[model samples]
Target: MTMNAALIRAILRIIGASLVSLVFVTIAVFFITAVLPGDVADALLGQAATPDAVAALRHSLNLDKPVLVRFVIWVNGLLHGDFGVSLISRRPVLAMASERLIHSLLLAGVTALFAVPVALVLGTASAIFRNTLFDRAVSLLTLCVVSVPEFLVATLAVFIFSVQLHLLPSLASISDIHSIGSFLASFSMPVTTLACVIVGQMSRMTRAVMIDALGSSWVEMAVLKGASPAHIILRHVIPNVIAPLFNVIALSLSYLLGGVVIVESVFHYPGIASLMVDSVAARDIPLVQICALIFCAAYLFLTTLADIVALLSSQRRHAA
Candidate 1:
């Protein structure tokens, strides 16, 4: 088949697989959440609530329905952009989630905006200076950072920056940001912690890719032709490695959604992951489920987009 047809077919397959994966994600999220300990009604009304009151509250929240039935209802509502009501607050789940999601997006987006470029530059530099002190230092730094958990990173950041240095706030609350300086101080730690994880992963993967590319016969041929290192890398190596680099980037950034949970919890940031933690504690099933699904959907979307880009890039390279 032609390259165009093959690329189209591959993209369609990726999207179809993503949709199927989303269906399973929904099922798993629903069943797992349904079986979580503690009743929503009991949590909302307290342990002292009468059985009749609990039953009435459950019936009102439609929690009294069969698990499968409730799943179907929830899925149907989800199809219509209705995430149902927050059992504790009596607010729409979508509205509550959207507010927190925006915070998360800001955190992750800002993290990516800085992380990607820094990672690419560091990785390329390390690869170019392979076996030198700079390469060893970059490798060691990434390894150490990768070995450390985000919560630890965040905790150390707080202790040093907030407690010892008194340069930044420990908490990343949005309400405290009254000016640009406050905004930076408020967000700096959380963003740094996240960037540490992302940059470590992306840079290591990028370094490996760049090293392999640099060792290729074509790269050697370019070197023998007296091409400048910059021209060879920027014109040839980067073009060839773009697909793999894009995949590394997408995967690293996808970790932001998962890692943000720990960062949010440690920093007391008002993001969806922390909201999910609260919802679980309050037994707000709808809110918890929606938050989980949003994370899953984002992961799938990034991976699917990466697949498409990789396919197109591969096809273009082959055509060239």
Candidate 2:
């Protein structure tokens, strides 16, 4: 198929997949929340409420309705862009989630900014020096970083940088920063910690892809033609390596979005992951469901984008 036609088809498929994922997220949230031990009414009202007040609260929140009905209502509200209400703060769920989502996205964005280029450069360098001391050292470092738990990294960062050195604040507070420098200073530790984790995974993926790409026929031919190593890598190997790296990038993006819960909580960063944890702990069903749906949508969208890019790259290579 033509590239334009292929692109259109891919876009359609992505939209369809996103819709399906949304439905699945809704069902998953419904089932997960329904099976939890506490009564939603009691969880909201607490032990001080009388039995009659509890029943009244349940009725008000529509917890008295059938499970199916509750799910439908929630889904319908979501369709209308309402993410329900937060039980703890008595605020609109979307508003609360939006605030936290922005912080999380900012942190993730900054982390990626620091991670992607560093990983690519190191990976390429290691590939160029494969089986040598440099390659071994890079590989060992990647493995060590990947093996360490994120929580430990965060804790060590807080201890050394914040407590011992007094360079950055120990607590994750964004509110006190009135200037950009201060904001970045406050954000540096968490971003650096997250970036370490990202670099570990991405560098490994890049190195593997580079190694495979270096073995391809084009690379060998370029080398045989007396092309400089730099020319061969930049002109030949990098383009070929991109298709495989796209998948790795997509996976890392999804991981950053959904898997940062532990790190966020560890550092007390007010990101979506932390918000989701707090919401769950508070039994804020609406907030939890909304966050889950957003995360699922993001994952589906990024993965689909990667698939499309990989397909297009492969097609272009074939055409060439």
Q: Write the per-residue lDDT of candidate 1 for residues 118-228, one digit (tens) a residue.
A: 999999999999999999999999999999999899999999989999888888989888999988888899999999989999999999999999999999999999999
Question: Candidate 2, overall lDDT?
Answer: 0.84
lDDT digits (tens) for residues 166-217 of candidate 2:
9888767778779988888878888888888788899888888999999999
Off by over 4 Å in 2: 1-7
Clashing pairs in model 2, backbone N/Cα/C closer than 3 A: none
Q: RMSDs, each prediction?
A: 1.3, 1.8
